[model samples]
Target: MRISQSYIILREVRFHAFHGVMPQERKVGADFTVSLRVGVDLSLPAESDDVADTLNYATLYEVVKQQMEIPSQLLEHVAGRIGKAVMDTFPQVTGVDVTLTKLNPPMGADCAGASVELHLINDKTKV
Candidate 1:
């Protein structure tokens, strides 16, 4: 049997502002929700009972926060960037699911929000 371990960090991230194709959007920044699911092999850590043997989630959070601060035109791009950032920052991270939600999209139609989700994995690892 195979075992999987993961954690999710879900929160609304507010930006000072400029991130969109329209001038209005750039002028009045908006609230965005960033949800991340990070997965890694925890067998070693579980067996050894050592923090050093596992990926540190606290460090991952800091990296995600830093990346969210940077403005991007498309939520898809933001999600991709965040996924890569997580993998690059944590060597132990094997896979990641990144989703970004725009609270107030410019669509005139009645809509709660728009979101995009992407999953990325480290090709080097089979986990």
Candidate 2:
């Protein structure tokens, strides 16, 4: 038999950034939005009501924020770094979804915005 699990979502956490391939972008950084979906075993935290038993969202935010501060040429790289960082720091994280959106991209296109999404699973051994 299979069972369903509930996940805690930290959605649409916004960050101002200077990340891009263009020089002007680095000089005049724009706003970047990051949404993180972290999957973990919550039963222990829920039953015990212990902060230590669950994922520390505050710490997670700090880790992401610090990573975003570093300038990068590609959003893909940033997203991958964020995913790896989370998995490295948190032992309970089984899966992670990272979406990085750059508002008003420099593509000079007629589109409203541009973004990239990356899904990372730590079970590299199986794949």
Kindly give the number of clashing pairs for every candidate.
Answer: 0, 0
Tens-place lDDT digits, model 2, residues 1-127: 2325646577888988989999999999988899898877778877789998888899999889988999998999999999999888885688889999998898878765678898888784222
Q: lDDT per residue, candidate 1, 1-127, as tens digits?
A: 4555655454555444456777777777777777778777777777889988877767776777787778778878878888998888876677888877887788886777788999898775667
TM-score of each predicted structure versus truth: 0.80, 0.89
lDDT of 1 at 23: 78
Distance (Å) between predicted and true CA of 106, model 1?
A: 1.8
Global lDDT of model 1:
0.75
Cα displacement (angstroms), candidate 1, residue 91, comes to 2.0
State residue 17's C-alpha deviation in candidate 2, in Å: 1.0
Candidate 2 stretches with Cα past 4 Å from truth are 1-3, 110-112, 124-127
Minimum summed lDDT over a 10-residue window in model 1 is located at: 8-17
Give the Cα lDDT of each candidate.
0.75, 0.84
Q: Evaluate residue 43 in candidate 1 and report its C-alpha lDDT on the 0 to 100 scale.
A: 77
